[model samples]
Target chain A: MDDDGRDRPPVPTGRSERARTAALEAALALAVELPYPQVTMEAIAARAGVGKATLYRRWRHRGALLVDAVAHRNARAAVGDGRIPDTGDLQADLSAVLRAVVDELAVPAWDALLRALCVEALVDTAVGAQVLEEVFAPQITLFARRFAAARATGHIDGSVGDVEAFELFVAPLFHRWQLRTGALDHAYADAVVRRGCRALSP
Target chain B: MDDDGRDRPPVPTGRSERARTAALEAALALAVELPYPQVTMEAIAARAGVGKATLYRRWRHRGALLVDAVAHRNARAAVGDGRIPDTGDLQADLSAVLRAVVDELAVPAWDALLRALCVEALVDTAVGAQVLEEVFAPQITLFARRFAAARATGHIDGSVGDVEAFELFVAPLFHRWQLRTGALDHAYADAVVRRGCRALSP
Candidate 1:
């Protein structure tokens, strides 16, 4: 949350906060409706009933606006501060977390939005970096925290790094989803969990 | 390679073969130079020194053209029939394969072209499916073949399906590359091989 005063606008007052929310909501709506490249700043401004100057003042480019918009939505949609539950059993927790992930991916609107974000990320590395920082990094950190707890309980090997270890479970789901290689169902999630548990064992 | 006669143009012969090569080469060249959405069919035709009619005769759309172009480049770039080498030592072979994969991903031009293909694949599900079937599926099959050999030699567990098991090693690499999560080096690749071997043990 280091504010260099470039990427983010000044802290908004109550009235401007509402306007900011409206602008972000409009951006997200247009994002899911149109391809990311086609979703222009002008369109978002018009959709939000704001002037072009107002939009530009807050966001430098369409990619920046879209990243913030998606980040906002992700934050709102997360369940209870977005921490993966550690129920003392790492396998069950991983299965439950991955199951929820697959379920979210099954929703068309959410999938489309995520696809758009992914396209934007690929198209612009700066956007990609922002997304990693604002979205995926926090989630990865939560997983790391959960892994630490699991390690304390002697559930996983102490030698394997949590970040790398977590990818054994999560990355396959992401890779499958990105490529449209197969169905993203509970079965696939469970299989990943099983493999992950086996891999992390001492 | 079932030809429904719709997805592919008539097999080129004699002089038309040159034109087909020219078009595909141009598509690949332009794909690396420009963002995928901006690489128009007209531009490709112009660059190839071929008429629009010649281009259209082969490919119905830009996506189709790009897919073939990328697939062609991939086939040619692949070393020795594109199979994961089965030297009877599964760990060393996987390490070698993954090491080569990371090397390929590091090449700037190749990375750009693959990024373009990935963007196109995300934008169009049809393109996505074609990329999987024509490109990734063959490679997956190769991995499956290697895993089958490994299983026979007792290198891995028999209970896990080869297709699903292969993801433990490959998907993490793909995910890391796509997300730019970390440095994809020999070190990362070797780490994955270690985790993969541990995960796949009987």
Candidate 2:
């Protein structure tokens, strides 16, 4: 719903598309330049040269807008597609996907932006919910699908539930990255895949 | 080191010890009551009824003081002893330890305080380093030690390194809790232990 609650779509025009693009771009840039909490709607409007009303019409609040902004960035970067390659080799496929994650996180700008979003999500429950829904769920669901297919094909043990399988494959990287406890590299990612397979494969 | 670069211990009188206790308690309370970045030294001093000079004399900055406050709370609660019960049943012991973590995180004040500390650690590299050293390293090291012992006893596969072993046993819970991705309960904790032991045990 837009700010006015009319539930109308974004004005579909070349100009409207440009403004939306500019607004999301500005939100991403400002999020990186300032602390996430301090990146206000007004600043995003000014940076994007869009009226506050227009920005609000598109997004309900800062959280909503920033969600779109980060999602936009991720889409542009071709990350979080939620589809693992299925060459009938589960470990090799998982390793490739996790290595891609390592590569994405290694980029400094991407790291800072994600860390900022993570800080915001940690503090605010509503934002956290939105992030879980829009950002993480798609990827999680797709990964679960891949796991189910693997189980059906006898690539993994059928006893492991989807949730456990997903956590087993991915949680180690998320844990290490969040805590800054160790290096997040291809080797660690491959180790996770190897361990996960040993635990799950038939 | 103290703020003045003098390496003196806190005054060892009974009165000084009481003051120190009051300060740490105040820091913990204020950290829960306020946003972490806004919880300043002066504010902690005022809340504790200790002079600001005395607070600084014992600790270098807000991060250092807050770390002590959190560690004190954990110690009083007996949370992070870094010792897992060696009942020769690795899965049961891991389940017991992880369930304790889940219980600790279930407390509202403890959750809020640790989340606040996590936010600060995420934003500041110096604070991050200190947190890793004082708050997380001990737990990780002790867990690693337990894994090594388990390996030597032939409880777990010897091929898994300490790093992979530790991550396998602990990282899933940390991942779920940090992301608020699912229910953090005894059942989930037990599931993680089951999966981990299956992955690691000979």
What is the lDDT, from 0 to 100, of the residue A84 in candidate 1? 81
Candidate 1 residue-wise lDDT, A100-145, digit = tens: 8899889787788888888878888998898887777656777888
Cand 2, B chain, TM = 0.81
Candidate 1 error regions (>4 Å): A1-13, A30-39, B4-13, B30-39
All models: lDDT? 0.80, 0.78
Top candidate by lDDT? 1
Q: What C-alpha lDDT, on a 0 to 100 scale, does residue A124 get in candidate 2?
A: 86
TM-score of chain B of each: 0.86, 0.81
Clashing pairs in 2: none
Q: Model 1 over residues B1-202: C-alpha lDDT tens digits? A: 3364222333556687878878888988887777667689899989989899988887878877887886666666653245778788898999998898899899787788788778878888888888887677667777888999988989899988865777888899988998888889999999899888988898
How much lDDT does candidate 2 score?
0.78
Q: How high a TM-score does candidate 2 get?
A: 0.86
- Cα error, candidate 1, residue B98 (Å): 1.2
